[model samples]
Target: MWGPHLLLGVLVVYTFGRVRCQFQYPTETAGKQYQVPQPPTYKPPTNPAITGIPNINTVLVKPPPFLKLLVAVLYGYKINRRIKPTPPIKKCPEGWFRRDQRCYFFSDKKTSWYGAESLCRLKGGYLAIPDTEEENNFLKETSTSEEVRLQGAPIPHFSRWIGLRSLDGSTIQKIITNELLTFTDFVPGHLASRGLTSEPCVHMDYTSSFLWKVEKCHRGFLYICERHLHFEFKYIV
Candidate 1:
């Protein structure tokens, strides 16, 4: 009887030990809850060579509205200065003959000395005053050609009023320019003083090779007008 009991007790002790070992070390199963320790997360090391370099982000930023407008204005002004510069005016207008940097206009109609001056003023000019022999010759040739073209015949005894006049009926000078008469083409023994009392105004006798002759201021005669050449730029848009 003691041997059977002892055998039974030994069997019981071995079976309990086996069960406790199985409980401590359980087997992996399909429906068991378990927490696995994750391995250390892998991280790539930073490069020390490029660590100090500036970061270049390609973000596009817009300029302020006023700054953009100012830049546009400056660019436009530069282009305009290069392309549309102001030009100087240096030529005579139409119907006015240019000669030695001056302009001349001979009239076909006759008028008194005062009327001639007033007409020249209306035409943006003054009574023609010949300052040199070349200018006198130019006036002579131009007048002769114009007269011949108008009448179809040579004028044998015609005179034209000039800018020379004796202020206070004494000293002769160019009335329009207030310049002394440095040059004169007077006939011999027929100087301006000879007619100072009767005629205060001077005239050019085209028949006598454009010689100077004093005449009455009230007398009507053809006249010449003079002006300076001027030019200006005009945009043609």
Candidate 2:
């Protein structure tokens, strides 16, 4: 519905945007930087003080020049109210993890179940272990977004390959409901130990929320590499 008020607001916005382009651009000029003198903490006797007064005792006390200079520089730099920080695309950048409110880059690409676990050790992330509901949600959301980006691709979606495997029953354990999470829409039974088609590695499938399938770990697929980066994430789920 095109209301009169809405039409007026649109006109104002268009005028504002058009008017901004009229501002003049600056020519390149190298500005000269000036240095300031620092005050001395301890002063030696100045050359020949007159009339019983020592210049050392009369010395002025001032802060270090750099400190004052730094303050002045900061004051000169305007904080633009119109300027805003760019929102990051994802918590754990492209091909990364938002685990436990922290961003990690899992460097391990593709390997067998044992090899994947070893790689996590080499890079300091023990597979993609989500310990809390918040963490599980964050990972789920992050993977879902990644899946959206990877839409129409052959592989559904994958974040990281865990050490747990369907072929190797002794090593694999059922991921707890509250803690166990998937990037793809994972339900309870679709992928509970079932990727045993040919290759025996189990990785979560992002497209199927209820499925975690097994694949050949040796073959290289895009992996969510993890490095324990300390960047924090604010979970919004």
- The lDDT of each candidate is 0.71, 0.47
Tens digits of lDDT, candidate 2, 139-226: 5566666666666666533545643444343233432122223333334664554445445555655556614556554533333334
The reply for model 1, stretches above 4 Å from the true place, is 1-89, 152-157, 231-237
Best-performing candidate as measured by lDDT: 1
Error of 2 at 91 (Å): 13
Shift in Å, residue 26, candidate 2: 90
TM-scores of all models? 0.55, 0.36
What is candidate 1's lDDT per residue for 14-83, written digit by digit as tens? Answer: 9999998877434664367766769999885687765655444522255544454455445534543343
Worst window of 10 by summed lDDT in candidate 2: 76-85
Off by over 4 Å in 2: 1-101, 106-119, 150-159, 166-171, 174-187, 191-200, 215-220, 225-237
lDDT of 1 at 106: 82
